[model samples]
Target chain A: MTRARPLITDLLGGLVVTAIGVAGFVESWRMPRFAERHADPFTVPGLTPGLLCAVLTVLGVALILRAMAGRGGAVAIPILEWPAGSAQRMIFTIASVFLYGFVLFGNVPFLIATGAFIFIFTIGAELLNADRELGLLPLGVGALVLAIVAAFAIRFIFVSVFLVRLPG
Target chain B: MDGFFQFLHAVVAIGLSADLFVVVWATLLGIVIGMIPGLTATLGVALVTTLTFTMEQNTAILVLICVYIGAIYGGGRTAILLNIPGTPANAASALDGFPLAKQGRAGEAMAVATTGSFLGSIVGMLGLAIIAPWLAEFALDFTSFEFFWLAVFGIVLCGQLTAMDDPLKGWIAGFFGLLVAMVGQESLHAYARFSYGISDLEGGFGLLPVLVGAFGCAEVFVVMRQEATHLVASKVGNVLGSALSSFRYAKTWLRSGAIGTFMGVVPGVGEDMGAWVSYAAAKRASKNPEEYGKGSTEGLLAAETGNNAAVPGALIPVLTLAIPGSAPAAVLLAAMIIHGLRPGPLIMITQADFFYSVVAMVFWASCAMLVLGLLLTRPLLYVLKVRREWLMGAIFVLCVVGSYAIAGRIFDVWVMIAFGLIGFLMRETGFPVAPMILGVVLGPILDNNLRRSLSISQGDPLQFVSRPISMVIAALVLAIILFSLPPVQRALGLVLSRLPSLSRKNGDA
Candidate 1:
């Protein structure tokens, strides 16, 4: 009940770490050593990375071993347990972030893109609020107002005040 | 003496100028941000760093320093009233603070916290002024070998201390951060390591964006995923009067401040540990240990003092060694570079006046926190009442803008989101993020130095530990790793458990 995934999470985490380590090491080995240019062998671009990936591989193995031995399986990892309705909230948050970062930004005008994102986010979050204080009309109006003010304030601060050349 | 004069000059100049007003507002802003549950000191400093991009260098650093100090102190108020620490650093404060609030002594608890924080900041500021110059001078003789070992030591020690229970995961995070830092072009060769033919990958990940993502955007997800918290104490009574009364427990604050300052000096292990260590020490030394978690004023004072003092304590390494002592200090270090200020072994010789100005900044920030905290105690409770649903959207938008404003690249925004997910996953998996952040900061230092050292030493690994300083640091790194191993830990536990029995048997004999 306490552990989110128990020994299985560590088992998976170890496998992933080990895979990353191997991939990284292989990639490092593929990097140029500049032997054709008679560059110093120790100064190869891949030297440090190769060494780090080797160490990582060993640590990953150790983690797997520990998990197999039932060590570190006593308690739950932090932030895994949550109240009801958390999954929906988390999924929505991830979706919103993805849409804004990958699609909305750099595609639409900064003001509209940012305002639309904020407005949608605010209203969506409020609707998810279990203890709703405001009715539909008031909530919509409030969300719209907040979105407009916050969006304008952010744009002004970044562009006009800070001189950042943000995307249109 | 010369340094003291420069310190005095900087203090007087800042006090007399328009910067005084900046101090008030910035510190106030930091308090409000800290008073909120999800906005951490790291996030606060990072968001504020974006704003300072257009200001003069010193002014920017000033704004950041004020925010750093104020945020640490501000978190204590939430711990007192809501029984939830506004920041991780204030978690220890809640042990005593909440009980006192439940006992209808919220005002007294806050007063003790304020006084403790002020004292801690002053003590830490003194440590910074005295320690930075000496450490800088000492580091002047360090070769690439020493620097390489220092990076290893920072990563290892940070991993060990930050994840006391699970050093394995901590080290994993640290190594992963180093790997992340390797994804761009190397220093000696301009070849991109893992760019995979992508154009944006050549320039590498921006530090600010990664930070904004990990601390800021990740905060949004965590907040949304959790149930909301409610405030306990509806009223904060007689703040000013209660504050003055805390001076009676001078011993606790002083001891905690000293311990806190030392903890701050340790790389990547910042204010949270500072408060915890100080609180533990205060409990150990207290005459009435039973009163510790049940409304003890002294415990609250120690926790607050220790955390606040660590703010200045954390700055010591950032100024002298270009290594951050905490997560927030990491952002500060990056901001220093952003503002065209070089911080390293030669900083004392190169930026003497600037160093003194930082000390003066800490002084002013502490004073501002004290004044504002005591006077506006009751009014500040309104901050805790704001609903998360209403606040999360604005906070997320700021995270986006903070990342974008840094380099004005949409790619950076993507990096922020990516790291935010990585950070969220890291937290959920029980891996400490600070070591990873520290690894990202120290990766280049580790890489360049190791490669350079090997080139000079002709591939002899022995040469890496030849120097006295390098040997000492190498030994420390080895010791930490060895002690953290599961077999070694179990053996030590068995031996320690047997020691008391052996002593008793000897007594019986």
Candidate 2:
């Protein structure tokens, strides 16, 4: 049994883009006609989606051709045989980011969250393939220092100076 | 005359005040940001622009100018130290710079790069001061049709110049970017094109998110996927010796600086093209063209000088015509607008003092770059010792925070992720990202201007060519497209080969 080519993904993406571009072109073409009907012009005059449709059609064709070409040569796709626990570590890193957004945005202070996020991700990744020379203590300290400095710097410069309001 | 004195007073006062300190600090920070693999000069300017929103207009302008100069200069560091260029502008540097590093002349290469960058910037500044007002007057004549052609020219030129192998790929990327820009609401009407009932999509893709995706996220993915390689850290030697060597090759310095400044003046063409074109031109004119990629001091100098000079050149259009010559300049234009400084025909009349102040800022920024470059050479060398994984991890955090911090919206974060994936795919498949970015940046301008021009003509298509500026721009665009054709290029090359008499005439003259 052979694995399926990523044709479904390609077709779905292409169809969606083509439909949107065509719809936009049609709507824009009728805009002037519609504007005349309504006392006030409902559309932007002279800016139709014809150019956009032509460009999109060309792009859609190119994408389909590329997808048909499929995966070529062994060197094209490098074999990345990861260490035993690297996948889990990678998942954890991505998860931490999601969690930070969901849980830590308003409740936890930025510096604390940043420091914790970096420390956790770094430690988790390192644990997969332990290196004795790279001590946890130094890594933790470095991450903390960098995170604290960056958080404060960003706050002071963007908020205090620029008056930008950032979420806690 | 009174206003002149006030401008002079403003410059002197600003120079002596803490504003100078802020400029220096911002320049240093920009250098660091540009020296990092995942951070670019555009991002550096955008980040700093937000930070300048509340400051005095002059101070803000000063800081932004410093960052622009420093970022362009700083990109050379990673290009020299590692084979990987820190920013796209430094890509040409890597061709000669990496070889120089391997041969253990990294310090000398860096020194030459710094000196060349400094000189190039100064020359560009001079051109800006002398030529910008006249150019601005020329730009004042540009109406809607001219602007439309200009935007199209920028996108096409970017595609032609930046694409390594396939110009078609570059154009495709650019078109894709234009398509992306078509998302959200149209500029004139509030009608959403492809929002698909999603409120978040209605706002369209943000510049910060798209930039972060293309530059920062794509870089992270590329680095992660690549096999880990070690760089041989070189010692920092006498930088002054390298600076002195630049003067020894005065011809190369002058030629490269001129090339850089010319490339910079063209709207939408940035420092990357400046560096590559200068390198190619230098190699072609060199006594030994064969030594180009093999640690040639002249090659490295040409690349560095052209890129740095392109920085000030890029600013001329933004200051004069309200047209950004580069992505970084676009961000700078936004910053200027945010500070209530409208850059157009009336700019010189309304804010002559501010214009002069910008010229002064450019001069000061170059000096700051030189000072900081000398001081930071040894210190920044330590960055090479950092582990790739550690650096990547930290950069990842910055990318996330940077994207989210721009607008306090989770939607932007998602946009960043989506675009990051797209950028990664584009890179993996050998599609140039620069064209995509150019398309996104110029899309609205093209759309708006094309519409306006048609409206002015009351739906007459011939109006596009009737205007003088538009005609010239259209002709140039057509010429560029024709030049890209193989037969036309071959014929042109043959004609060029028959120019020995022209060369001899020059020698005789």
Displacement of residue B82 (Cα, Å) in model 2 is 2.0
User: How far off is residue B429 in model 1, in Å?
Assistant: 1.1
DockQ versus reference, model 2: 0.23
Top candidate (DockQ)? 1
Give lDDT tens digits, candidate 2, residues B24-106.
Answer: 89888878877876567876786666566667888888888888888888889888887877778999999988888888888
Can you list the residue pairs that collide in candidate 2?
none
TM-score of each model's chain B = 0.98, 0.91
lDDT of 1 by residue, B128-243 (tens): 99988999999999999999998888889888888888888889989988888888998997878888899889888999899989888988988888777888888878788888
List clash counts for every candidate, in order: 1, 0
Model 2 residue A118 CA deviation (Å) reads 1.6
How many Å off is the CA of B254 in candidate 2? Answer: 1.3
Error of model 2, residue B396, in angstroms: 3.9
Pairs with steric clashes in candidate 1: A110-A168
Question: Cα lDDT for residue B476, model 2?
Answer: 91
Worst 10 residues of 2 chain B by lDDT: B224-233
